[model samples]
Target: MSGSGSQGNGQRLRADCERCAGLCCVALPFTASADFAADKPAGQRCTHLTAENRCSIHAGLRASGFTGCAVFDCYGAGQRVTARPELTPGPEMFAVFRVTRPLHELLWLLTEAEATGHGGAARPLIAEIEALVDGDAAELRGVDVTAWRARVGPVLEEVSERVRRGLGGRDLRHADLVGARLRDGQLRGTTLRGALLIAADLRGADLHRADLLGADLRDADLRGADLADALFLTQPQLNAAHGDGTTTVPGALTRPVHWPSGSSPARHEAPHRARGMPPGKAAPVGGGSGLGGRSGNGRRTGRGGRGRRNDRAGGADGTEGPGRRPG
Candidate 1:
């Protein structure tokens, strides 16, 4: 079950579009591509958005050339900004979303750390970071993002390492591990941030506390993989990756909305099981609720990443990731 995020001052890190003001659709920019239908500038509303700040083409985002929207999650930043209407729109508004994003991500990881029985650095980092996050937006902007990352990143890394010693202390950042065969590998505490894991075989891998930030997991098999306390991993990552009910996820994350409701997906029930594709198959381009079928059966056709939107995260040293806020 997804956490209620009701602890005294805990935050809800998932996007709540109903209470938002289409901030994501306007605050962030997007370029036309397989992932996006058109180019929109920062602070400009997406053409597909409605007057009431709702997405007009939300259900058929992919068909309408806005597949990027389907994979994006604001982690509740949009609602927070909307609630504080006093904050003017523009750079400052955008900054509030951007600055809070990493902080909320940190909160998510801290919550997971606590859930997984971690009592060390996570608790201290959570307390310190939460206080900073709750401060004024201007104060948050004054914060040195890099310096703060330095303090929390290393601590989280160490805690994850001590807890799950599998491949501990390995700096696998920006590794080109695409299509590599490592089913059931011990990747605990490994820095897989920015790694190209497209079509990789990670079935049953032990990924406890792995830093999967900006990692591309399209069509990568995750059946039975233990992703407990994995850092910076979002729902889109899980949706793009292939996993069964047995795949262990962090406490703050719920199963992908598109996954099969069982421990494993059978060929008969899976719609994306095409021939000539890779071992693990990705789902439809913009369909994130189901596990993606990258090269499964007949879905290969050509050279495409596991999930279309996933390419953003793994793009350019794997730092792009989902854009700010949510519609």
Candidate 2:
């Protein structure tokens, strides 16, 4: 269900570390955990960030104890912010990243909104955000996120409404669908935005063009679920969840590299078996050089974590393992 147009839009929402100035590496920090190997302070350059802004340990983040860094996605803000003409490699970049990152995230959602035929409803907010993203550094530095949200939230709500309307009259927005049985269901164009789908069984379900923006999918099962053209489904969401090689993700997305290489029964092979699935679709969850992936396995690192964020107090930010949202 993912047409070419949607895939291009989805790629823009992902973090391209190579195009970034190692902002997430230096601007954010983390505490030692299943995901992170140590406690770091905001504005401190990560030990792994190199002189050229490449992560020295990117390929081995999980092995190095920094899995949280592997799953975090900047929604393309990192590269945009790093493009400032006078930008230099220093702690000052953290201030700019914090201000601009969330705005970029808004673009992620807005892009999904547009892709799902809700562009007209989301256009105003999109234009406003575009102006903000394109504004001078001083204006961006002085942004008021509260006002921005108040103005844009309603448009987001409208976008959600339009998407839900296309889901065969279902309004599953923000629904608590954790551990629920929804196998082989028809769920096209559904608004699952902000829904908690943790550990839910979605195998063999058709979820074409479902708006998954902000939906917490940590540990959700998607063995053979069809998420073709699923809107706003990011690599971070994929990294947080479990899926076998059989899961039909949108062409724009890649399967999380940490998923278990295990193969169990196929749907056609065991049609009578309900809940017949691989116990887990991923290897032990942890951070890599960024958010997470198979550490030191030579497989590409996966998009990485939701950190213990430090937006206002400027405490520390970066990866966290499962159970709690990032600190």
Candidate 3:
């Protein structure tokens, strides 16, 4: 679950589309698939993008085969990039956005870590990343994101270990368990970081305190699952999976609107306010879920790093692509 007192930083990690300039709609590519109705190349403005920098079809994105748009969280990168006058509506802006997106994601992780009571260890990294994020567009574009991840990934892993300290569950890091049947399993405190869990049957499973960083949950069944306090669980991961009203989530996340209304009694309703949302402001039409970081086959794609599709296709590092849709 989300720790108290991190609400301020959490607000910065969320995408505020009202403040953005349709960067995701213009900078990212989407192939015609079940997730998208048509092919769109990078750097081209989406046809559905309105003159006011909003999605014209925002209200009916999923119904119009643009489910991908509904779940693509920019981690607040879009508004950040748009705020810079030097990088406005050009290749440089998109390039900086590509880099800044992952940096913001790292910020999200660090903030969550601090919220979970690792502030002493997580604060420094958070400060360092914040400095990078606030740098000029040129500096952001030049950042070696791969090297940064290499340094930061271990710290996050350690944080996960600390959070999951006594529960004693399986260490399934990077394990390939796609399509596995694990309904009602006892998985509290399991380390499933980077696990491929696509289409896995996890109904009624206990995942409290389980580490799910970079786990591909697309098409996974989460009905009646206990995910309260699941470490590093993000809105994008929840958006990709199938859950119901009975599926318990962390206090930091809002329930995805796409989830089926269940007959089971609801557990914790966490705050209705979306993370990163401004106080007293309503959530966007689609609830403004996080970005999808998984690929079609359930692999975690890197964001804005070497071998990652910088300013092009695929997801930011450690998450699924922006083009992914509900399963």
lDDT of each: 0.55, 0.55, 0.63
Flag regions of model 3 displaced more than 4 Å.
Answer: 1-8, 264-327
The top-ranked prediction according to lDDT is 3
lDDT of 3 by residue, 1-327 (tens): 343324845667777777787777777666565456666666787787768776667667779876556655677777888888766787888787777877777677778777777646778888888888787668878987656666666677777778788889899865766667888999999988666675677889999888787676655778888987787777766875778988888777778787868744333222221122122211111111122122222222211111111121133532223432112
lDDT of 3: 0.63
Against the true structure, whose TM-score is highest?
3
Candidate 1 Cα misplacement greater than 4 A, ranges:
1-11, 88-91, 166-173, 184-193, 204-214, 224-232, 244-248, 262-327
Flag regions of model 2 displaced more than 4 Å. 1-13, 186-190, 260-327
Lowest-scoring 10 consecutive residues by lDDT in candidate 3?
303-312
Question: All candidates' TM-scores?
Answer: 0.69, 0.72, 0.80
How close to the true structure is residue 306 of candidate 2, measured as C-alpha lDDT?
Answer: 25
Cα lDDT tens digits, model 2, 79-196, are 7778777677675566677667666656655665666666676667777887877777767777875456556556656765665563573557657665777788788877675555
Score candidate 3 by TM-score against the native.
0.80
